[model samples]
Target: MDPIRTDVDAPFGRIADLIALNARQSPDRLALADAQDSIGYAALDALMDRVAAGLQRDGVVHGDAIAICAASSVAYAAVFLGALRAGVAVAPLAPGSTPASLARMMRDADARLLFTDAAAAEVIGAPGEDAITRIALDASAAGQALADWLPPPGTRPFPVDVQPASAFNIIYSSGTTGEPKGIVQGHGMRWAHVQRGARYGYGPDTVTLLSTPLYSNTTLVVFFPTLAFGGCVVLMPKFDAAGYLQIAQARGVTHTMLVPVQYQRLMAHPAFDAHDLSRFQYKFSTSAPFNAALKADVLQRWPGGLIEFYGMTEGGGTVILEAHLHPTKLHTVGQPAPGSDIRLIDEEGREVPPGEAGEVVGHSSGMMTGYHRQPAKTREAEWFAPDGKRFIRTGDIGRFDDEGFLTLFDRKKDMIISGGFNIYPSDLETVLRAHPGVADVAVVGAPSVQWGETPEGYVVRRDGHAVDAAELLAWANAQLGKTQRLARLHFIDELPRSAIGKVLKRELRELNPS
Candidate 1:
């Protein structure tokens, strides 16, 4: 039996089809917007057609990759959708990545045309000796500008067929070392996501405020759904707590997907309570461990159904915790989503009994096809069940409660073995976050002579709060088990995070002495 449902005929076969339909049905509705500009559905559709024509004229054909590294804007969205319309896969590279890494990824994707804005072009100076076309989204020294690159108005691209199995986009992982592996997400997978998202209240009247970068899947999950459902999307080039609230209130935003750090910042901002967010019908949090305390605070202060999604970009079984409905289960990541099968496996690859901690693995219709061009790495990411079903290994240590909710401990690689005992850094960080002086905290294993490894903490203090790291460490240790006690504590202004707000634990580990 195929996991994806084939019984019901979907209204649109591809994402581009849905966009085209919306343009014909609601031509004057707002499709995309930013602080500077907004585009209606009709104009967005025409722009995408021209973009497809331009790419076709420039030799970007079916299955070929087109790389875009720029701030989110109307033009960026057009280029992305236009590539899809032309049956080409998009490789949205992170602008925050180093120039060397960016260049390496472009080579790996074999991207024929590279698009960038002025700010990103400045950072990504020049393309390597490899011959590739560079098209700047804005005026810059980076090859030709958008106006010069696009084909003449009314030029139409040749029709190309798009299958469900066709590659839709390549999302690179946030690996700190070496080149990041590209996860190949197919059109069917994206369609599954869009269909599933409609249940969460996305529709023609829905307005989604995207504060994260377009390159991040966390943003695309909401971004594509809003457009596919004929809703409006407001893009934020850079997230600011004050500015987000103002936009949310002014735009009458009905939906949003934000990481935990963004929520924390919004909650901490002085003006957060001043704005009216009652228009929000649904709010999403993912890509990090959201503290239960913070979830409770948001539920109390913010008006919306708070949902937390726990899964990886590589696609596996997803766990959805509706924090608004299940207030008591806020500690867990909620139950497995409908039709999603989740199980825990021991280090030896044997399935663990319920209520026991093990590596989290899952199977679902929405899983990615595989890591791009890396068969060995792709095989390493899979775990086969006895019945011959394949599951994606999440690399997270978690246990299911009697109620079937999953409680995550830490990353499998991040777990510390101290004196032959497993020490989960998340357990220690949870205790540290409870401290009044501790605004944020991250725990990582530090090499030790006494034991193979021990826990060390990096903490950020609350505003206007003065407390010694030694005193806070002592207080936290008093509440923790002997093996979980921190060996050292350091105070920093803020914890380093990725573009989507996941803590960079590898960077913290590098600070520890070997």
Candidate 2:
């Protein structure tokens, strides 16, 4: 059976048609804004046609795989949409990822061509095991070059039919466990997810201030919905607390999304209190579970503005919590999105009842086709149910309430089986953060000879707040279960976080020797 088409056509309606619609309807309206400058819908549409022309000229044919490795810019979007129009599969690599990682992704995704900006061209130009054709993506020159190739306002659109099930883009895994797996986002799945998200709240009138990197699935899902709804996007090439607030005020941005740490930083910023941020309508956060304390802090400051969604890139949005519902269900990730279903199942694949912890499995049209080339993993995630429906087994573990609100319990892999007892690190970290001197904490399962594997607490104290390791350990042990207690303590000045401020526990695990 075919998947549902949420939008006018399929969400994967030809990129050419979508761009042309925006150009015709909102020609003069601003579509993209960044540190450099803003570009309107008409200008962007014309530029995309040009990019498409250039790709065609370069021998890029339909179904060609292209790598987009660069920072956030208007040209980046033009190239991405242009590639889609040209029927090329896009694989966007993170800017900060090592060349080794980049090579792995390119090879894994079987990308034959790379489209990169000048800044990171040197890094992305390095040859891998498999040779790839490199093309320079000059943001400044793209519009002109495209115009040269096709002539802006005169470039002929490609005569191609891109089906919804056709390969649209490849979103790589976070690589938290093993090498990053490329998630296959079909033209239809991408469109369905974007439409579902936009219909929920993200719309044309909304001004989305993006602080996350362009490579992230969050950015991919958010950007299209904002554009489809005729909303303006203010791009933060890289996240900066002070800069974000300034941009929010200067641009009169109505909506934005950030990880939990970014939210904390915004609240911590001294200027946060000085600014009149009443215009801010909705703020969404994910990538990590949020704490009730942090939610309270944001609510006390911004009132009804916080929104949360629970889902990863492979699947689009699963659950959505609005600002109004947030107060009633503080820790819940909210209810399932429309046309989506969630189930909690045990390791043996048995359905677990409400209040019982199990793996969170989701089913929706927005879910990716599969992990690129990893047939084994794909088969496991996208399996058939007894009801003849398809479902993806999210590695995450969570439980539901009687009211149907979901609360994240822990990751299936991250669960510490200490002395036959299952312990969730998040539970320990939350308790540790309650202490006055403790600023932030992460709990990991360290190998233990006696109990097989035991939980270890790593804490970063507030500046100028000195607490002895013994005292901190004692306090943590008092609050935790006998099996969940920290085997040891590692006091660090600061935790190494990702571009989005997610604590890199893998780094900590590598840094701290067993």
Model 2, C-alpha of 188: deviation from truth (Å): 1.8
lDDT (Cα, tens digit) per residue for candidate 2, span 1-85: 2121234445346545665676787799888888877898888877777767667777777777788887887767777887787
Q: How would you encode candidate 1's per-residue C-alpha lDDT over 261-302 as one tens digit per residue?
A: 999999999988999999999999899999999999999999
Q: Could you tell me the C-alpha RMSD of candidate 1 in Å?
A: 2.8
Off by over 4 Å in 2: 1-16, 125-131, 138-153, 198-203
> Per-candidate RMSD vs. true structure?
2.8, 3.5
- How far is 172's C-alpha from truth in model 1 (Å)? 0.6
What lDDT, from 0 to 1, does candidate 2 have?
0.76
Give the Cα lDDT of each candidate: 0.89, 0.76
- Clashing residue pairs for model 2: 164-188, 204-229, 204-230, 204-231
The prediction achieving the highest TM-score against the true structure is 1
Which portions of model 1 miss their true places by more than 4 Å?
1-12, 176-178
